[model samples]
Target: MDQHVKTLAHLFLDGEEDKALHFTEELLNEYSLMSFYEAIITPAMYYIGELWETNQISVADEHLATAICDFVISQIKGKETVRSGNDQSSGRALFFGMEEEQHYIGLKMVSESFKAHGYQVRYLGPNLSLEHSLIQINKFKPEVIGLSAALSYRLPGLKEIIKRFSELEWKPLIMIGGRMARKFALEELEADQVMIVKDLHHLSKWFEEGREGLINETS
Candidate 1:
């Protein structure tokens, strides 16, 4: 583990919002936005999760850390400009955590990644129901939809959500992500229009290369 990541994790666990924000700002000077997310914030949050899982930290402690991390992410995003030069017409995307899935920090990072790449984004945060999701999908008519789940038990719900999304008339590209995505093969979910993106780096690569045919396939 990087020393800086450890320090940031400490700050998060201690609920030191100002210190965490300042430290992250220093890191931003040294790293690109995506790099800071992938190399630093992601790992620190993972460490926090591990501690919670092992009962080293209380649930309240975990929540405090998560809140601080969320604050830091928002601060970073506020300071940065969207770098994607793509036309907004071809770049609409919507992201949300699955129903009952409350872990949305990763989802936020994914949304920011898309935003940085110039995608017009609607990030609905965590625990959004399917009916509301459908409403937004109909209104926004995104070219892509991103869904996230952290726990394994959310698989059934994830499948149902994907099935409903696949049935949509517009047939937007569907992306599955979060910890479960990294741990599972999810081969059954991959199809002509659905993809499992394990991390932001993979997502970035897709934006650069793999997205050519996929985004326009339904059109």
Candidate 2:
């Protein structure tokens, strides 16, 4: 854990937006966008969530912290796109959360990872139905369909979505990520169609391997 990351989290929790942003910017100079995300920002977010879960902070406090974190990440996202060299066809991915699952920050960070690496990310956000997602998948025709479920209760919805994907003939690869996502056995759903990303580093590796597999299959 970077020492500055702990300070950043404390600033965010204290609702010192300007200082937090400044701290995040300073860290940006020390880390790549994804590295900052996977290290500092993500852990800061986890701490915020933990604070809320333990009743140490109010909902408004949590929301404010998240907003600050989101703003910082958006700043990095712009830089990423400019340096991506305009390769629009690197691959496409449709990202969404299960129905009634409102947690989107983690999913959005993952989407940014894809975008930073030149993948076209179609983010549908949270509270999406399987039917709706299927429609988007057909329209998007993404190489990957990414889903996230931040809460354990939403796992059923995530499972249902995976089931539908498995039943499809031309299903895209599925990548699941979130705090609670590790509780499930995603591999049992199907072969080469489902994966569980344990962290941002694993997510990076998964995209690399998944892209190679897609290329191999297509060629």
Candidate 3:
């Protein structure tokens, strides 16, 4: 993990896109997808975010790093694999980033993760209106509705969206993630059936626990 972390940090921070891509591919060849995401991709991005927070790096640097990581994740996710457990998928889902929230890589990763698990995942990237999101949800009729907001300022918007979703007569399971997700408790939000997911591991664990759908059912 340390070796991969250093490699990712060097490649990503130095603006070496081709090198970064090659390095990521090499890691994928040598390790599991989850290992690459958890050990290299996720941790590296978190460090980059922290660097921006502490003024160690410029916003442009952070954005570039994120874009590169985004490309790498998408590349890995596009690879074919033989899934082992249930022959059937867990369920369909619609994912989006909240209004004016531009940090969307995390949500993108979630989309890829769902797709890996054979879920019909619809990823509407970044800064979508509630009304627009609702339209997709209605159209998709997904079993899960996912929301991500990296900015704390978007919490009110997130709250409003979740509240409106809760009022729906036939609501899907709602999952929210991002840095701000850790700031507030669920009870404070006054919404049941709403889950706060911190990372891909937690999201997959939710699937394994049979919370999202019948993932453990026989093939």
Q: TM-score: which candidate is best?
A: 1
* Order of models, best TM-score first: 1, 2, 3
Off by over 4 Å in 3: 29-31, 80-88, 190-192, 212-219
Better of 2 and 3 by lDDT: 2
Model 3, 1-219: lDDT tens per residue? Answer: 487786797678787878888888788777666556756777788788788899999988888888778777777785523543435677898899888888887788788877777788899999999999889888888888888877666677788888888776677878888767655554455344677776667676665677734222211
Candidate order, lDDT descending:
1, 2, 3
For candidate 2, the 10 contiguous residues with the lowest summed lDDT are 210-219
- Candidate 3, residue 99: how far the Cα is off, in Å: 0.5
Off by over 4 Å in 2: 84-88, 183-185, 208-219
Residue-level error in angstroms, candidate 3, position 77:
0.6
lDDT of 1 by residue, 44-117 (tens): 99999999999999999999999999999887784444444444544789999888888999999988777777
Error of 3 at 41 (Å): 1.2
- The positional error of residue 219 in candidate 3, measured at the CA in angstroms, is 29
Against the true structure, what is each candidate's TM-score? 0.90, 0.85, 0.84
CA lDDT of 209 in candidate 3? 72
